[model samples]
Target: MVDFGEILTTVGDFGFFQKLIILALAFQNVLFPIFFCSFLFIQSDPERHCNTDWILQADSNLTTDEQLNLTLPREEDGTFSRCQMFVPVEWDIGAIREYGLNETTGCRDGWVYYDTLYDATIVTDFDLVCDRSNLAEVVKTIFMAGLLAGSFIFGPTAESYGRRRTTQLPVVLLLIFITVAGVSPNVYVYMVSQFIVGAALGGYRINSTVLEWIGVTKRSLASCMSQMFSSVGQCVMAGLVYAIRDWRRVQYVLAGWQAFIFLWTPESARWLLGQGRTEEANKLIRRVAAINKKKIPENLLDVTGEQEVQTHSGNLVAHLSKYMSFICVLVILRFSLNLGYFCLILNVGKLGLNIFLVQFLFGITEAPAHFLCVWVLELIGRKKSLISSLLAGSFFCLLTLAFPQGEFHVIRAVVITALVTTGKLFLNWGGSVCMVYIQELFPTSVRQTAVGFGSIAYRGAGLLSPLLNILAVYHWSIPIIVYSSLTLTSGALSFLLPETRRKELPDSTHESNTCNNCI
Candidate 1:
């Protein structure tokens, strides 16, 4: 009996048909980050200060700055305090200014915003600053929590229901959840919607059987191309933020964009074969064969020894028991890379550049990073590529500490952002290639399941990234140090992973166990 892998090789696995599937699925990859990182723009807290209208009313002659000085308390460095005001007094504003009153308290008449870039955001509209500022991060964490839950749900389904249905399920759910988030009546509703959106994204990206559609040899190329679209999505999201000042409109635009993906995506023929639906699998395979202008021998169509196909699902527990250690390394790598990557992304505003430009730069960098990742993976192989990328990312993180953060604020921001961007770029560059590396590390029977295990770490780090932003406020260099340490440690551990540079993919547990470091 011909195994499905042999049939795929016969059908021209990386041909026109696979390319169409890759292109359709790339949209999903793009949408994932838009939802994941939407908080950067949508929940941004702009500059604010206590309302001084009472002082203004008491002295009509006072200028805005003068009113601010008399009513708004000043910090040690002399900037107007953001959350406190002078206690109400019987003295006129002129008397208050002349006497220099010292008593201060929180604003009783709400607050005022000035010089804010966004017309509306969750922070400003919901007043999630000061004591409530942490809620912004809480909502962000809620999304990651959903993703952790999804990693479990989608993995088995991707194996059983097949990749096409698994991919479509999340896209449909994303559309629904994001729409609810856009129209949410309050922060409570929005946070709940964000959680569901996270779960959908986790299901899609983590359990991605997208790479399984093409030949094992072509997996790197397809992943590179799709991730380029992921980068493209990042740039597109920045443009969306720039054009649509209102956060709701941005969410709506992204939700509307997924409609095309819901309509056109194709199922994985390999998955169909695994489910023992050879007839249905061949129907799709024939379309691929036609697309590639290839022909199959009539006898090759008959699939027998179909016992393995029928029992693949039941075989997972047996497969994983032997491959647990290798999967653990991958899970750790996922956590480390994402923790550093997202730490920088979630704090883009603090980088001291035009928020749109900084975000656009972050997105644009990933395109080249994906391409570069593929090239490096081909040249040096997976093990060295990850080590080199991680080590360099660590070095750059330390390099940021040496940057002159004195007085020239714009110059300082630009320099540090450049360094941080390079650091994150390499982490992601290695990460893109690592997907193929990890997938190749396992037998075909349990590849999606292995990916699910890694996504747990990936999403867990995502959950931690927003809370990690708190470290930045205590000291800018602290997050850089923490991220660098994690990447460095993971890089050291990566040296122990077996390289899969140019080998045929193992098709079963017996083959994989004897491969990698086993021999």
Candidate 2:
């Protein structure tokens, strides 16, 4: 039987039809950041101080600044304490300045945020400051836990149900949860809503699975182009937040825009074909050809499209049982790469740039990293590329040690931004190479399973990386040192996998010298 890939070539691999789908699906990638890092904009801990309502009521004649100095306690650096206040007293209101007190207590009445960039946030609304601030991280961790569960659950569900059904269910749930989150009355409600949205992420592929219709040669190009769109979405996210300053409004506006942006997106034709629903797949294919102003020869599709698409239900389990050594290497390497990746991602707020601009620049750097990996893979092949990228990223991270984090703001921002961004660049390439190398290392039947297995370890790193970054409180360089060490070790582990450069895709494990060499 002529495979779907052969049929896709005849219909035009990277034609206008695919472009329309890419355009529609790209918005989904853009919309993801609005939820994923919505915490950054919605829960940001702006400069805050204890609310001095008692003092303000005592005297309206005094200016705001004067009342702040008289009522609030100061730290050693003379900055007003965010979590503490001078004990409320019945001192003579006029001569209160003369009765200066050294003893302080926790913010009894609650805290107030400056609300510079955001009009309101969880920090200001719930008074998640000082002692209560750990709850904010709790909420974020809960959301991540939900994401981890969703990633595991959705892969199997997508195989059982049609891709369209999987997508439709999640998109609807995500919209509802996002709206609920926007209008949530309390932190618990908001976090639960965020968890639901995170769960819906498993169903959203951003059209990566759809590109499987294209042949291998064109599939790589299509994948790269699709990923670039994801980067474009992230690059523009900060501007989106800045323009829509209120977090709730940002959620509402993005939800409404997503409703329209995805209107043109249809179901995946490849998925339909995989389900052995040829009639439906053919209908979609004809519509695609019409949109692209091209024609599929009647005889060509008639001959090939009539075949039933059989799926191997045991493929994943079979691979898992057989490939212990390969799975081990992938899991460890993936965990290390992800640990470094998220360490940088979660700690960006401490990195000294405007959070909005930092997020945008973070997105801007991603697209080129893919191109760089492709270039390096050509130059050095997959194993060496992975090794060099990881080691080199470690070097950049170590360079961050030179700058004293807090004292040299202007200099640290300039120098560390360059170093961290470069480090992320190399780690990102290492990640890309891992994916490419895994596919090459495994036979077709088990490739997806291997990736899924690796992802479990990777997800663990995502959850753990943020907590590891808590070390920043003790010393800013500690997280960087940890990330550097992991990268170095993961790169060393890359030596275990066989080189696949200039080699054809092996059809079976017997033709695979990779596992044998490692053994």
Candidate 3:
């Protein structure tokens, strides 16, 4: 019986047909970063102060600075208190200014946020500051929960139903959920909508299956290219956030952009072949051949051992039993990467610089990182690539602690930004390498299931990443310490993983277990 790899040889692998499919998927990826990275701006803690405008009633002539000076206490850093104000008195302006009202209380009105980067965000609109500050991070965690929920629901669905149906349905749902999130009347409603958006995103399982359509030699290239486009999406989102500072408007634009992905949702022929739908699989192969301007033998899939096809559809439990050790290591590595990567990305605003430029620089760095990952994965192989990048990321992550805390200086900000950006660059390299590495580790039947396991581990880490910022309350460097520690341990653990460079993707558990070149 001819396997799908042999058929791809006849169908012109990595030719016009595969390139067109990749282009469509790449365009869809460009839209994903709007969701992945939007919160860096959407939920930012902008510069704020208590709305002491009530003091203006007593002193009508007082300028804005004068009003704040009389009404609010100043911190050691010389910034006006964000949540406190002096008790109002009927005394004249001269007497209040002379006495300097000593009684302090929480703002009876609200806050005045002079956010330099954003005119309005969920933080400003909903007053998620001071007491309610932690709520913003809670919302991010809930969204990641939605992603985890979606992965469990849709990852299996893709294995059972076709990839095209599973992918296309979520695009429509994302449009609806994101629209609701844009116009959410309250934070509760917005949280629900964003959770649904995360769920929809989880359901959109496009990346793992992209390799099923291409040949082995092109798998790394396709994986890197898809991630590069996602990086491009981050850059585009940075520009979009700069253009439209309103978080709600950013949501509306992202909602409208979901329509583009609806144009293309191709099924994986290898998946079809594994499902034992020979006729459908043959038609897709012929179509691929036709698009690539190649001719295939008429009886390409005519001879088949039905039992061998059944082996490609084996259940996840059976496959897991055979490869539990490898998969567990992958899950841990994924968790470490997600925790470290997101902790750094979400903290971009606190770098004390132009947030938009910093965000853009972070996104742009990923492009070169992806390219470098492809080179390293091809040259040094997956195991070494992951170890080296993770170690390098850990070093840069530690470098963030060199400067003192609680004070912002231009030189300090520059050094911090450079260190964090360089760390992100290497972490992104590890991420891209991990993705391709996962695809190679599992067989066709259980690939999505294995990816489901990795996603669960990572999304759980993603949920915790935002909350890790709370560690800053204890000490500013605590979160950085945590991120560096996890990445370092993950890098050390990577030695247990085997390399699979330029090897055929395993078709079954037996194939995966018995492969001699997996070393």
Q: What tens-digit string does per-residue lDDT give for candidate 2 at 1-519?
A: 555555666676668877766566555766765676567665456788887778766676878888788878778998988778888877767667776766788888877777466877666777777887887777767776666666576645555564456656777787788889888888899889888887776446411334444445443344445456666677777788778777778778867865665645576565565556678888887787777677787765674434435442245565456667777887898888878887887776768777787788878988887766556676677788889888988889888898875564677697888888888878777776776666556644444445556656666677788788888889877888887898889888888888766454333444464554664
For model 2, give the 10-residue run with minimal summed lDDT: 205-214
Q: Estimate each model's TM-score.
A: 0.87, 0.81, 0.88
Count clashes in each candidate, considering only residues at least 3 apart in sequence or on different chains.
0, 0, 0
**Every candidate's lDDT:** 0.77, 0.69, 0.80
> Model 1, range 1-49, lDDT digits (tens) per residue?
6765677778887888777777776757777667754568854556789
Q: Rank the candidates by lDDT, best first.
A: 3, 1, 2
lDDT value for model 3: 0.80
Name the top TM-score candidate: 3
* Model 3 per-residue lDDT tens digits across residues 224-261: 88789888888998899889988888888888788655
Residue 147 lDDT (model 3): 84
Over 4 Å off, model 3:
36-38, 42-112, 205-209, 305-308, 516-519
Question: What stretches of model 2 exceed 4 Å from their correct place?
Answer: 41-45, 54-81, 86-105, 115-117, 205-210, 263-316, 319-327, 371-384, 402-406, 435-451, 495-519
